[model samples]
Each structure stands twice: as structure tokens, then as C-alpha cells.
Target chain A: MITITGLQKRFGKLAVLRGIDLNIAPGKVTAIVGPNGSGKTTLIKTLLGLVRPDSGTISLAGVSLNGDPSYREMIGYMPQAGKFPENLTVSEVLRLVKDVRRHSGPLDEALFEQFQLAESLNKPIRTLSGGTRQKLSATIAFLFRPEILILDEPTAGLDPVASAQLKDKICRERDGGRTVILTSHIMSEIEALSDILVFLQDGKVFYNGTLAAMIHSSGETRLERAIARLMEGGDAA
Target chain B: MNTTTVRIIKFEFSDVLRSKWVLIYGLFFFLLTETLFRFGGTSARVMLSLSNVVLIIVPLICIVYGTIYLYNAREFMELMLAQPLRRRSLFGGLYSGLVIPLNLSFLVGVGLPFLLHGVERTAHLQAFSMLLLAGVFLTLIFIALAFLISTAYEDKMKGLGIAILSWLLFSVAYDGVMLSLIYRFSDYPLEKAVIALTLLNPVDLARTLLLMQLDIAALMGYTGAVFELFFGSIMGAAISLAALSLWVICPMWLGLRQFRRKDF
Candidate 1:
């Protein structure tokens, strides 16, 4: 339920997102994969209104998001590192988010319980381990049951159990007809979770299609090999 | 003034209050004031001595603390930006969050000592109030200046360097340049020029305000007489207060503009 046209972003002389035109439909997981410095984060940041595009328009369900922050309420974003105020406790961070969102619905304590964060409620964020921090980030992202989820490397530091729990949560969200946009380096996670794949190269979309279509076109059965071949093939022509 | 703004301010203020550095800052002031009182024979002498100390230390603390806090709060700011909150509220919250606790700390640390020492009974009460007022103004002015510098650059070291340099320029170097200008233009009519120059630097403006109210024109020489003529009256005091307020507003406005347009 998002549309971006002619989106270009440049950091000084380096063009990060060059002429991007993308559409993300609802009720599906759209996995964005790319090599390092391929503007995946920049593209996501632009959609979140964190990075102002040099030239382009991003509309959410046909309404322009320029200078309007209210649209962000529909988006639940989990940043890559999940850096929080060091002094605030886990529960405090959650409470702060809940306060900001003003969500009146019954709180989703599933991820909170799954991650076993209840015991660590009083522990400061600085004291939490990296995996616990990721759990906290994951819990907050799904806490509001938002219409859309934008997760940047959501499982980067998550342990195996937490990661599986998160993967299941993503699938459940997709089944519930919620849109999810995620970026991850793990090929298997993308293959298992995403319905549509958008591969980026050098600040431009190199390939966009279903996993089956990408494999068929690349003449490779495996998703990773297909992506590698697609990178070598160029333009997906 | 929305709930989000209030929440942010509450969160930030409590977070900063819990920091040991802020406690150390308050204790530092408490100890310094107590020491000044013990050493200086008369209450008037103590107020004058504390003015110099306040002039130098308050701006330094505000600049250093403000820059460090802004840089440290980068992640928290990013988190808030992703929320459904307005940019104005976020910024307003963060600014007030920093300013309120700092103002309270100064009031408690320094004001308590003056009240306890019974400086209110003496003629130095006006000077004491002036000292506290100037301290508050300088704290705000330097904090705004720090925010401006922090927002302008991406590099933390560079931002901090510029902030410290700015504090140096206003507190120490500005006075040196002003003196040199006065000496060089001794033959020219520089009363109005000197007054204008003094207003440009918040530190100098504060010192001039306090010194004028102290009525020590003979000790201050030519610039003192000019200041007395202009700042001796209520109108001049109002003008100086306005000028100092401008120093706080102009930089903060510019910084907030930059903050709004900034890409996190």
C-alpha cells in the first residue's frame, strides 16, 4: 500500500537511491535484498521520512507524505541497531512507546513473553545483552499490531529461538493480511518469509519478481544461486 | 504542549537527572559557592568573585553538557522521529528537557547558598540577583549555541570542537578583541560602538549588566561610564535583557530549523 516514483537520494557526490520507482502491495512480505552500500537502508529511510529524497514523491495509499507525520502512525519501524536511551529500563522503553502511540487496544504480550522480557523489565537498556535488545525491538515492532511493519535486519542479533519466534510472527502477520517490508542479508530467511523479492544493485532495482520467477529466469533452483546469477546477468532482461 | 511533547520532556528530564554528571554538576556548584563564601570577607566581595566564576563556568558547562547530550541522544531522537509525533513537539520537548533541569540545578546549587548566607539583607542583593539572572541567560544562550553547532555537523568531535571554540570566542577572546578595538580607536568616539560590541557577546553583556548595577563606574573606566548612561536606567536594563533573550532565541530558532530539515 505504498508507491514511490522517481525517488533519488544523493549523499554529497555519491548517489544512494537513483531514480527508484517501487510499489509495495498489502498482505504480503516484500523482502529487499542487495549487496553492501546498495541503498537498501536509504530506500527504507526515505519511505519512513527519515531521509528526504533529493527528487521524488512517496505516497501512502495515494496520499503524499511530505511534511505530514501522521502517516507514520500506520508504520511500525524497527531500526537496524535498535539503539535506545541507555538509562531507561526495558519496561520503561515499552511504556514510552505505548505512551507515544496511545494505543488503547489490549497490549500484545506474546513477543514480550516469548522473549522472556518480563523478568528483565526493571533492567536498564544498557545492561541488556545484544540479543535481548533485538528481542525488545521485535516486541515493540509488533506490539501495536500496526498495519505495516518496516523491520531493518530485525533478526541480526536475535538468538535461534527468538529468531524463529520472530519468523513465525512475520508469517502470522502476513497471514493476517498485514504488510511487511524487511531487509536482511540472510538468504534463507528471505526465501522462507518474503512473497515478493526486490533485489537492488548500485542504487537501482536490478530484479523484482516472485521467488519462483526469479529462479526460473536465472536457470537456478536455489534462491541464493539465482540471486548471484541474477547479479552477474544484469538488468533481468 | 501535547502529550507526546510532555512525555518526551518527562522522559528526557528524568533520564538526565539520573545521570551522575548532572549530580556532579550540581555538587560542583554547591561546593564552589560554599568555598567562595568561606574565602571572601564581605558578601559584596563574594558576589563579585562569584560573578566572574559564574561567567566562565556556566557557559562552559552548558556548552559542553549540551553538545554531549545532543550527540548522545541521537538514537533516542531517531526513535522518536519514527513515531507519529510532530517534529516541532519532538524538538521542543528535547530543548525544554535539557533546559529545565539545568535551570533548576543552578537555582538550587547557587541560590540556596546566597539565601542561607543572608546576602539578601545587604546592598549586594541586586548584584546577587543579577548574577543569577545572567547565569541563567548565559546557560540558555550557550546551550542554544551548542545545539546549533551540533546540528550543523555530522562529526561528533568536530561538533564538540566548534562548540568549545564558540565558548572560548564569546567568553575569553571576545573580550580581548573588544579591548584591542577600544585601544586602537582611542581617538575616535567609541561609546556607542563599545556598547554595540558588548551586546554581541552574551558573556560581556552579562558582565556589563552586573558591573553597571554594582555602580562601580570608576573601576570600569570609559566603557563603564557609557554603560552607566545606557544601562543605569530601566529602559537600558530592558534593552540589555531583550538583547540577551535574542541571543537565546536566534540560535535556537536556527538550530531547530536545521533539525527539522535534517535526515536522520
Candidate 2:
């Protein structure tokens, strides 16, 4: 479980996360959705310890994440854009990450075979297309079978077939009792995967609940329209 | 110092080696050294000429390459940031990755030429070693300065500009400014003041060390007399080298502070 309380962060004069308090339970998928500049990425990055908060406490499995980075070992993060060393081959990149993680468990090559990256192991990262790069990112994020998987726009550049394969993988991970946190602009992806929806606007959480509760409260049957209605000041009573 | 840092260093070294720039830099030094030895008559004369080139060019290349590499590696750094690695190890790995290769290039480029030309046969081998040591110090000092600038500013153009300007100040413009300072205060008993000022710039400190090592203080005019009085002894040379090492450490320390607090 990941617990955060009183999380606040500001970049210069612009506040990115404003006193966010959230509890992310294990074995469930929580999708963070927000409009541009609404702090979705900032919230995720703060949770990943990439962005230090102004004042707050984040604890993973009851351990405080204050200047202690060992907690990151249990978490897997897939960045929005997978930026790797251009000179490294795909296999070399994987080796480097694995070397850093030093996990002794059985390697998970399910996604590797699903994405067919084995064929392109020798190709340099700079030559890969955007979709292929996304595949590689997803592969690394799942390689260690981390307890908490945080994926940012994981399906943004993937094809439909690859996208379906990833959704299945997410569901499988959830079934195996791992917490999954993701942020995506695609409403369908959110509807298909999220067990709970957290809507953020202007650095504040406007709605946090199950999809059914959010839809029922906002008086909109469709998930996309319900979020739009919430953004338009429709009170979630 | 641990296995992770060693792994990062190996990864980064191979990455840099593939870029071909370090190889070209090595070749540049090799060609320049060979040409200088071919035309400068004696090894002593060539060593003196090479000191001028090393003091100026090494810092310029080190700063520019260091800044650009840091900027270019920002993404790769972000990738590393998310991993289960300590920030200090990452920074240390990247720093060693860059400095080690450049130093190797310098060694192979300049060191090989000197060896092939029979530096042992020359009476000025001590001067040559001092020159090489100064070149290595300058490389480290300027690269650390570049890391400082790159980490402090988010704007790449601004960082690049400041890094180059800093090199220019140390290598070329600083001497001009100091000369005018001496000229402006010629009668003010400025010998100690000048030594203090020279210590502030690594390039000048290096030049003074090389010149004093070559025993050419008589040609350095007024400031030379002060430098000879101070840096002419073995203890003074050790002190100046320690000061140069501080120049390398201080900026790197500042850069690491910035890097630690920075949001990727």
C-alpha cells in the first residue's frame, strides 16, 4: 500500500500538487485523470520520488519515503516518453536496468515476447520508432514484477494489438495482487482498466471514487461526460 | 565506489566511446603534438609550445564537451533517476564516465607522442610531466565547472553560453584583464596581490607552475619575480597543485548539491 498525506509541491509561482491526501490500495488499478497542467504528471512523479514535495509524507508499505530511496526497489515506473541512451542497443538498455535493480527473481519475459523486442535486441535505441520505444518501456517496467507498477501514458503510442496485450498484462498483474497506478488521456483505456478514478483539476483532487460512484454522483452515464461535467462545476454530491 | 557505480561507469564509458567524439579528440591531440615536435627543434622548445596549447585548448574542449554531454544525457539521466540508484552514485558515475575517457584520450594522444619522440632523451622531462599534470588538472577543473553551470541552469543555450564564456575568461580574457590590473597598479606593490589573483584562475596557476618548472621566471618580468619567490620551491609547487585540486573539487561539490535538489 502507498499512503500520502498533505502532499504539496510548487514549481516557482505555480503550484503543482496542493495538499493531496490519497491512499492507494494493493491489487487494484487507480487511474489519475486530469486536463493539461492539472498536475497528473507531478502527482505521479512525486509518488515516484522524482519530484520532492514542499511538505508532506509519502510512505510505501509503512516505510517513510523521506530521503530513503530503497523503497523504489518495490516500485516500477514507466515514464511518459522513454528516453534512453541513444548509443545503447535495446538489449544493452535492458541489461543496464536489470544490473541496477539487481533482482534475483525469475525474469519475466512475457512482455518481451509479446512485443517481439528480442528480434531487435541489437538495434540501437535511437533508431527505434516511438511505438517500439513505448513497448520497450513497458517491458522494463514489468521486467522485475514489482509490487507497485506506475505507468504514465503507457499506451499512448502503441498500436491496437500492442495496446490490448498491455491491458491484459495490467489485468494479470492486478489479479496477482500488485497495485497499478496509471494516467491516460484515453477515456476508453481508463474505463477498461481502472477500478477507481481520481480526477484532478488545478492541482486539487476534485473527485475520488469508483467509476460507478463517480458516474452516479455526477449524473452522467458515460465516464468521459461525467469527468467533463465534474470539470464544469457539477457538484459531486 | 560500489558495484552499481562501477556498472554505471562501464555503461557510460561504452556509451561515450561509441559517440566517436572522444576518438576525434584523441586524434586532435596526437596530430597537434606530433606537428609541434616536428617543427619546434628541441623537446624543451616543444614542451613550452605545447604548454601554451594545453593550457588553452584542454579547458576549452573539456568545458564545452562536459556541458553538452550533461545536457544531452538529461533524458538518460531521467531514466536513471527512476531506477533504484542513489543520486550521488549516478552523478559520480556520470562524472567519472566523462572525465576518465577524456583523460585517456589525452594520455594516448599527447602521452604517446612524447614517448615516441623519446622524452627520456630530453633534459626537460620534468617540465613535460608538469605540463601533462597541469593539462589533467585543467581538464578536471573546467569539466567540473561545466557540470556546475549545466546543473544550475535549465536553459541549454544559457548553460552553453556561460560555460564557453567561463572558458574564454579563464583562457584568453583573464590574462588581458590581469595585465591591465598590473599596469593600472604598477607602483602599488602588487606582487602578492597578483599571486592571489593568479590562484583564482586555474589556467594562470597552471601556466605559472609550468613556467616555474621550466625555470623561466627571469622572462616573466615583475610578476615572475613574485611567482619565482613563491612557486619556485618544491613546497610551493605542491601547494599550487593542491589549490588546483581544490578548484576541481569545489565546483563539483557545488554541482552535486544542485543536482541533488534538482527536479528531473
Each model's chain A TM-score? 0.96, 0.97
- Tens digit per residue, CA lDDT, model 1, A133-237: 888888888888888999999999998999999999999999999999999999999999999999999899888888778888888788999888877766465
Candidate 2 ranges beyond 4 A from true positions: A234-237, B120-123
Which stretch of 10 consecutive residues in model 2 chain A shows the poorest summed lDDT?
A: A228-237
Model 2 Cα lDDT, one tens digit per residue, A1-237: 989899999999999888888888878999999888889999989887788789999988999887766788888888999888887899999999999889987988899999999989999998999999999999999998899999999999999999999999999999999999999999988999999998888888878899889889978888999888887783444
Q: What is the C-alpha lDDT profile of model 1 across B1-264, one tens digit per residue?
A: 888899999998888898867778777788888888888756777877777788899899999999999999988888888888888888889888988888888878888777777784645777788888998998889888888988899999999999889889988898888889999999998989988987888888788777776777548655656877766645666777899999999999999999898899
Candidate 2 lDDT score at position B120: 52
Off by over 4 Å in 1: A235-237, B120-123
Q: What DockQ, on C-alphas, does every prediction get? A: 0.77, 0.78
**Shift of residue B19 alpha carbon in model 2, Å:** 1.4
Which 10-residue window in model 1 chain B sums to the lowest lDDT?
A: B216-225
Model 2 lDDT, residue B1, Cα: 91
